[model samples]
Target: MAVSQTADTEELMTCLRIQLYHPEPQNIFSSLPMDNRLKQEAEDPVRLGRAAEACPFVLNDTKVSRKQLALMAFRVPGSTEMRFHVQNLSRKGRLQVNGIELRHLVGAELPDKALIRFGRYEMLVLREPGDSETHFEVLFERRIVAPSQEMGEGEARTVPVMESEDVTLSWREPINEPSESDEYQNC
Candidate 1:
């Protein structure tokens, strides 16, 4: 029993960690319920795009068109190494890795901290849990998308800043007395 459990653990450790970032406000699917089959790579190569409902990670950005598939990721047949492939759906659609726009590159070996920008979305490719460098915190300034003073509605998106500070806020004095009338307290 222990040996089988260890094998399962090893298989999970070989999987790649993919993080999605976008210029638009997007929900982090870490808390979302993942398909058991997909988690085990039952589908082999997972399809990801606006139309891929079975995709473990789905992008819900406005800039992403729901016309065709955008990206594909899979593990090497018998190896633990993973590969990422991209498909340009639109004439103006593009994918960028680490700020380098890939025009002719169909597939490439995913490296640690590899930044992928597909359409208006940016994805961070990370190694599995074994890497110490993969553990870090990301801080976002604001939650909702605020109207930009310069741009029109829904034109601006908040960018998240990487912060090292563990303490988010400083301690404040505790309020002893209630702001409302004290008569209610006596009752």
Candidate 2:
């Protein structure tokens, strides 16, 4: 009976592979590399922040708060499939998953493939069906389209660009100019 229970526990284990990228490599700080890989098991929630002692995956940036966020793994009732959720922990630095923004203490279910951005750093999170074995892979960079190619030839127009690799302009609505009160919200 004990053996059967251990097997069941092992079967519920899942792995997450996070590949970090810096869009502006030249401007990146010396502490942050251009591309990095981090792998973790879904057993415990993983914390991410600027503090090395508190977070296993340390993001060394001034814009990043001491406690930025956490990723937790869970399984739905009556299902063996593992799922992940992200919680924003920083009161100042907002977290962006895909194209949606999450404020402090807010959490959302993470997709199998998600583009996460915080503190000028971007990471691609991929869910894998397995134990805590480590894996690494390179992520594709966002393609830059010239303004002239996307807009009408004669008319001068400005387009809002989302830095995430998975997001496209087609579905995104144009953002209005920020008000005076909204300007300092992120600060």
Candidate 3:
């Protein structure tokens, strides 16, 4: 009985581990290596709430500032998209990337096409009316990229991932050029 109990304990441990650490498909992102994401189910209500909120309508920027949004970071999300989507509940506001107005940013999936080519473009969203001011400064950061008298560094190089169209095509040239056109030209 003692040996059997020890065997059962080992099996239970193995089963629990598999449940806790399933990978692939939708892998959970974490700052921890050994820590199981399942164990973090009860960690933060606010964060969970934010994720839930953001996933549907709030789904835009991974992080949002509650204060002055003086700086914008229009970096390529990967080797792909250079624009990031943001939801501004601030009412009557202007968001500009490197002085380029972000009116191009719309829809949940479409970020502004103009904001699509910056290593890290800086933006300033000025709220003129409605909502509140407390939201601006708390969420804002310094220019995403520092502006200098040396402006050469500000040139945008990031390309939008979604805007890329497949241009690779194969064409079959006329095996005998003039078989049709040349015979007609003789007339």
Give Cα-based local distance difference scores for all models: 0.39, 0.58, 0.24
10 residues in a row with least lDDT, candidate 1: 131-140
lDDT of 2 by residue, 1-187 (tens): 3366555353323556665655554433344332443344546577778787776656657677888888887676886677678888899988776656777888777767666768656666766654432222222233233232333423212222233353332212333557666655775
By TM-score, the best candidate is: 2
Give candidate 2's root-mean-square deviation (CA, Å).
10.9
Q: Write the per-residue lDDT of candidate 1 for residues 1-187, one digit (tens) a residue.
A: 3366555333333344444444444463333333222243323444454444544334444455443233444444775444444443444466554444444324444443345556645455444432112122121122132213223323223321112233121112221455777676855
TM-score ranking, best first = 2, 1, 3
Clashes of 2: 0
lDDT of 3: 0.24
**lDDT head-to-head 1 vs 3, winner:** 1
* Root-mean-square deviation per candidate: 18.9, 10.9, 19.6
The window of 10 residues in a row where model 3 has the poorest summed lDDT is 11-20
Q: Residue 81 error for model 3, in Å? A: 11
lDDT of 3 at 65: 23
